[model samples]
Target chain A: MTAATASAARADDPLAIDVHGLVKSFDGKVVVDDFSLAIPEGKIFGFLGPNGSGKTTTLRMLCGLLTPDSGEGTCLGLDLRDEAPLIKRQTGYMTQKFSLYEDLTIKENLDFVARLYEMDRRTERVEESLKHLGLYARRDQQTGTLSGGWKQRLALAACTLHEPRLLLLDEPTAGVDPNARREFWDEIHALAETGITVLVSTHYMDEAERCHEIVYLAYGKLLAKGTIANIIDNTALYTWRANGKNADRLASKLRGCDGVEMAVAFGADLHVSGTDEAALEAAIAPYRHEEGIEWFRHKPTLEDVFIHLTAGSKDNFS
Target chain B: MKRPFSITRLSAMLLKEFNHMRRDRTTMGMMVVIPLMQLILFGFAINTDPKALPTAIYSADTSEYTRDFTAALVNTGYFHIVKETRSQEHLDEMLTRGQVQFAIFIPENFTRRLIKGERPQILVEADATDPVATGSAISALNAIKPRVMTRDLKGITMANPPAPPAFDVVVHRRYNPENITQYNIVPGLMGVVLTMTLVMITGLAVTRERERGTMENLLAMPVRPMEVMLGKILPYVLVGYIQATIILMAAAFLFRVPVEGSLTMLSGATILFMIANLGVGFTFSTVAQNQLQAVQMTFFFFLPSVLLSGFMFPFRGMPVWAQAIGEILPLTHFLRIARGILLKGSHFADIQADLLALVAFVIVSTGIAMARYRQTLD
Candidate 1:
């Protein structure tokens, strides 16, 4: 599509990222295959996938960091192919790994980023970003010396300081602690509140739950995309939570039982999930009357649905 | 019960190392190719006794005596008289510009003075900046007298061979009268040092960014490839100047090598040559996948530069093919410009070709580097 049509579509639809039939391959191996996504402006969309499931590839293609093999898309109301430079100018991309210059000081790193974007008030922007990230006190310290959480915070600040209209974060909080991750999510939400769209790839179930919508990809294919409630309802997975003495030990016995798709241990409890509720009940009927065991029908968690979806998908690598 | 040195464990470690080496094909190729290439290049291409030195003949007389004299000089196989000029100024220009290494001036009265039995002087001015290149050729001049006199005056010659032609051969070793090797080597070292360090420093610049994962982030932003290349190269240009300054100072004070040309000209040419080397390094960085490969690529370019650029050996001594290869390297042209300016006091017009070659190197290398630099994570 031309830029005019893309902008017109955006005018009518308010989508920050609207891409379809995007296919990308590396060395003859398809990393993102015929994928389509449309995220409305200001919505926080989470991308969930197994490792090497093409989440990163799809995110990179959306931000113009990579080109799709055969695709047409618009990011921030600009054509993904012809207007990539303009799209890049208005997009912020946070890499999965720590990608800032480790030898440079934190302030220097921010200044470098500011200069790269040719921001008008470079010094003021850098100072403001440092203060906002609570990095002003340690701005002079070299980035390599900082902890993992601090490094991520600095990366986020550097990417967003340009005030991009769209942010593509690829596992931004992969190795960070829970507290730092929560703080990062808060900042993401705050940015979203100001109308900046965020598309973040994550493996954390809780993080996915916080997004307005979630996309689950397996083996370069999008298996599901919707709100958490919609995805849970679509899966139609029946789960039984067993809580009692030796309940966790019953996981292996129930794993290969008839109609039991997955039996996973969550702390002291066992969550047995399946697609067929009657067969699942029949499989667990013998254990229903077992001594010192309590079984209750439970709603399937997001992790259960995702695990089930990924397990059924083919491993493209093999 | 376990032994300190088990054969199984040692074999396992050896096998693992072998696997790693096999996987890194470039390193494996370099491991064998570098030494072999260096051996062939240094062994076959290097010659200290450089022959066929370019000589210009300025004979105002053009008589049979001068012809005999020129023939005798060419017969020695040391001098290759590429240009013949009647103007003494033209001969001087040839030598000053390094178009010719030696200038043979036979005055108009040469044949007359010879027949009159008066000892006439035959002046031969040798560009002795590269002392090794001129040593054997100058020594061969002494043997020419007996052969030329015996061949020219066959009918009237006595058994004494015409008393050595009734002439004195005035050998003027211009620029470096004492034939100091350091005068040539120390100035050439400046080019070599800059080539080695500047190429390595800038070669690692982009590769280091890629290896450390910063290149992805940098490419993701709105930066242009030219901006990235120039940004990586400009810092090293200053570093190159620092290196040049240190070498120049040491060459002046410590080694007592003269800087005969204009210091401003030297600095200007050095800056261009530095940028050329930085461009080469940037190109290597683009081609190399990691810092290690970048270092290897730098060495691959550097070895031939040191060997074929006339830094370690005479330039004219090597074969035409090696010279052709050396001509492509910035170091080769820079060496000529460096030695020409520092030792010979060559003018801008004298080293203009070499300077142009370096500028071309900078432009071409920068273009290649920018072309090779990826703007996407492909």
Candidate 2:
């Protein structure tokens, strides 16, 4: 939804975050433009963007870890500017980097975060978190000794120990294996089912599909925001998949064509997509009857939409 | 296949290292600032042969000869008459309070005795807590008897062509009669050691977290700036006490340095001093971006404290401006407290001013640290 309409979301669904015209900059360069978002409570909201696209900056702003250069908003019904401390108390933010102390044991890290929140029954909570993280047996091991997957999991557990109502995860599973990543997503969904709103930023398309709604940012500007189907449908992008000998090699030749917005090789098949259906059909007419080459009309995937959105925006840093 | 050292490769490495140095502006500034500071300190601030020491004079006689003798004392360039007391008790208070380094007491009927050829004696008491501060001034007193009252003593047989001295000048060195340097150095070492370690260690507290990428996590939590500052610095207070305990033990057992005052008072003062230093370190951590910058800032402060705080040099020897700078440092006041209690057995009333100064330092530095501390990553 547009920033203007964000406040008008249905009354029954309370917005965990409702921000408008949020702008932030660093060193005279804008890192996040006039971005706005509204995520209803209990929904897992996905944030998609490329490197240096202001995803982390926006997440930091939402959780009160950073102040917007100029903006007005509320997270969990508290003013983002005036009540940041109160907002921070209710919000759990997992940074993109592994920020927990490496020298501390897994149990110690969780205990420290618990103490900061002044949570009661800290011992019981820490033990439960250790078990939930599947690190009960090795809770005393130094966090630095754990692999990337375990470290990420421990960070998540530490942030959620306070049982915050809203969770802002910035690339929480960026460097994890497939199985660990899936497990992490399952935990996120489980938290959301308990009525905790989550705003997670990730580049993984599979992870994006797991969210109830998604927002795409490029060059510090919000390009798209909606459900998975709504975002893809909003692009109105047409696609064709070519499966034949040297199909993937056609990406280089088809990239700059007028009708082809993105010509990406998906394994053995080449998926070419564009907004202009007629131009795309005419552009691929020559290859339609080529020897040993077969082309079929294909539905646009979420990856296609993501690539199309990122390819259209300018880089703010440049 | 390559030579022992390729000139091009060497030049490349040199350029890279030079760029690294250029980019770290704090280190670059420290490199230039430290030597320049030392030069200014040694060339202008430090003086071994202290002159114009604050001295108090009390005399019962108002005769012209008495005025002439006092004038002769000022002419020696060693004694600066700061206060002229009416009674001997006032002179004693001035010396005990460290308000004056030297106090000269003229006995009753001093001019009558001079004419009678009695050779009456005048008492000159020196606060010998710091022997170096009083050594040369005592020697300067010896030269005074020869030239003083030559015209006033004329027509008196005692002054006929300067026959013997008119009167005896009896010098009394109080606090440390033997002029042992260890008494001064050993006590002053406590303040120096605490200042060095506490400032440097707590200086790295916040910046290390920032460098290790844990500061973001800490800041993102529900912790306040004061909470983080106190949490980081309070533990170092205990560390400072341990260091102080070791130094005190060494002073008592190894160096034979006497603790003349209440040990409880000294312990309390040491804690206040540590908090003041830790506050300064925490302030530095907030201003520095990384651990290296924090350390550089620490030395920038630490060098001046060591030099200008009068731990190594006579405090009154420096120019007024340098002493004024020294007055602002916590170490300067701490040195006074340490030396006063250890040497003079000073009570709370004697060292209360320095204690108040350290309390003020703790409040002001911690205030600035909290004000400069960024609550958000803005």
Candidate 3:
């Protein structure tokens, strides 16, 4: 399915990443299967998937860190295959792991990155980046000695020192504290507002809710893509909430019943959802009259829709 | 109630180690292949008693007695006549250039002097640069006198009854007249030391980046393959030069090994040899997966170099196939060049062929390394 057409937001905006049928394999095992996307400029695009769902592979191909086995695409208006070096020069890619030299100081790491791009006014830019990340006092500290949050900030500063047109972040906020993650997102949003397009992959549901749009992948396939509300609405799933004493206990019993695709506990309540409305209502009919229990119709959440989509897809490895 | 070491835990650790060994196939292959290679090399290739050393004849007198004397020298199985020249300069040139191990010069009237029992002195000049190569060959030279003394002349009869020596064998051991082993070893040590350190050091260069997970970051940058290779290799080349200089200084001052040839020429040859070895190290780094494997590859190359390159044994003593393998190693050629300059005082013309071989090695190894250097993480 073409995920670009599914999203109606900013339909007329120019695309920063326009890829089609981006298939990639390792040792004949397809890691990404016929993936395609068209993300507009200056948008915070979230890539959502489970483990081994081709999110990292797709991000690597977009940033020219890896070549697709067979694909045709343009990243920042340049051919990905023929103009990789050009794409690399204009693209800022933050790898999943911290890839900067650990032996170098924070300021030195930034300076080295600036040198690699052959950027002008290197010392001034490196100083500004060190100050921007709040690492000015510790600019001479070794990168290996930084905390997880500081390392992530330093990596972001290093990749963006050249002022790239596009930024590809692979789980940029992973292993970071909630406060630091919020600050990181703030910086990302700040960058996006300045007309830099961002494509970030993450597993945090709250992080997913912050994106202007999201694309969900499973089994190397694009299962859904759109705004969070659009995806939740498109799922057409019916949900009911049961809030009372021991409402969480009913979840295990409701699960595996016909028409009950998911029965998950949220604190003192149970959220039961399914795509078939009538069968779902019928499945919970017998529990509605229970003593000391209250039931109410509910709106399906973004996490509920993702869980439903994941259950419908087959695991290719199995 | 835990025991100091449980049998089950010990067995589990043993099994885990065995599994790791099985997974690392290169280490396992080396464990088996290196011993077998050493056995074949030591058992079949090495010969302490070298024979058939190339000899040239410069006979001013061509009589039946001189012909008999040359035949006697060949029959000792230590000398093989490779050339026959008339000029005295050509005979000395062959010995200096190491083309012939021994030069036999017979003065005029050798037959008449021997018949009159005048005890003619027949000079035999041997290149004693590698004393081991000429040790048994010189011993075989002594046996020729007794064997030829008993041989009867076809037409001429001895005036005196062979009581005095018919002809005296004047064995002149050249280059290293006293056969000082240090003279051969100290110069060749320059080549051996550079090979040991330079190859292993640069071999770890790229592999360290890869093992540390920095190569991916390096590849994502705009740097080209040649740029990365040279950046990694050039610094180590300077280190090699420093090492060569130290060894040369020690040889001159401590060992008293004469630097007969021009220092500029030797330095030029040393630079070429160092680049060739660094090229080899860089190529090995590209092929190996990690630092351990890179070091193993260096050992595999260095062992053959030390053994077959005539550092520990005579180069000519090895079998034909082993010599062919040694010929491919840069250390073998560099040894010849170093000894040629420091010991024999050979000029550029004498060592040009070895220099050309070193040039070819530098080109081919560097070309292969550059070709194998991955531009992308693919």
The TM-score values for the models, in the order shown, are 0.75, 0.75, 0.75
Error of 2 at B9 (Å): 55
2 versus 3: better DockQ goes to: 2
- Residue A103, model 1, lDDT: 67
Best-to-worst ranking by DockQ: 1, 2, 3
Per-residue lDDT of model 2, residues B204-294, tens digit only: 7678778888888887877767567766676667667867776677678766778899889999999999999999998998889988998
Native-referenced DockQ of model 1: 0.22
> Please, what is the whole-model Cα lDDT of each candidate in the order they appear?
0.82, 0.81, 0.82
Q: How do the residues A213-237 of candidate 2 rate in per-residue lDDT, one tens digit apiece?
A: 8888888989888887777667788
> Can you write out model 1's per-residue Cα lDDT over A74-161, one digit (the tens) per residue?
9988999988888887899999999987767788788777766667787898999999989899998878999999999899998998
Point out where model 2 deviates above 4 Å: A1-9, A315-318, B1-174
Tens-digit lDDT track of model 1 for B43-100: 3454455779999998878777778888889988889999998899999999999999
Global lDDT of model 3: 0.82
What's the CA RMSD of model 3 in angstroms? Answer: 14.7
Weakest ten-residue segment in model 2 chain B by summed lDDT? B1-10
List where candidate 1 sits over 4 angstroms from the true fold: A1-13, A315-318, B1-174
Query: What is candidate 2's CA lDDT for residue A243?
Result: 97
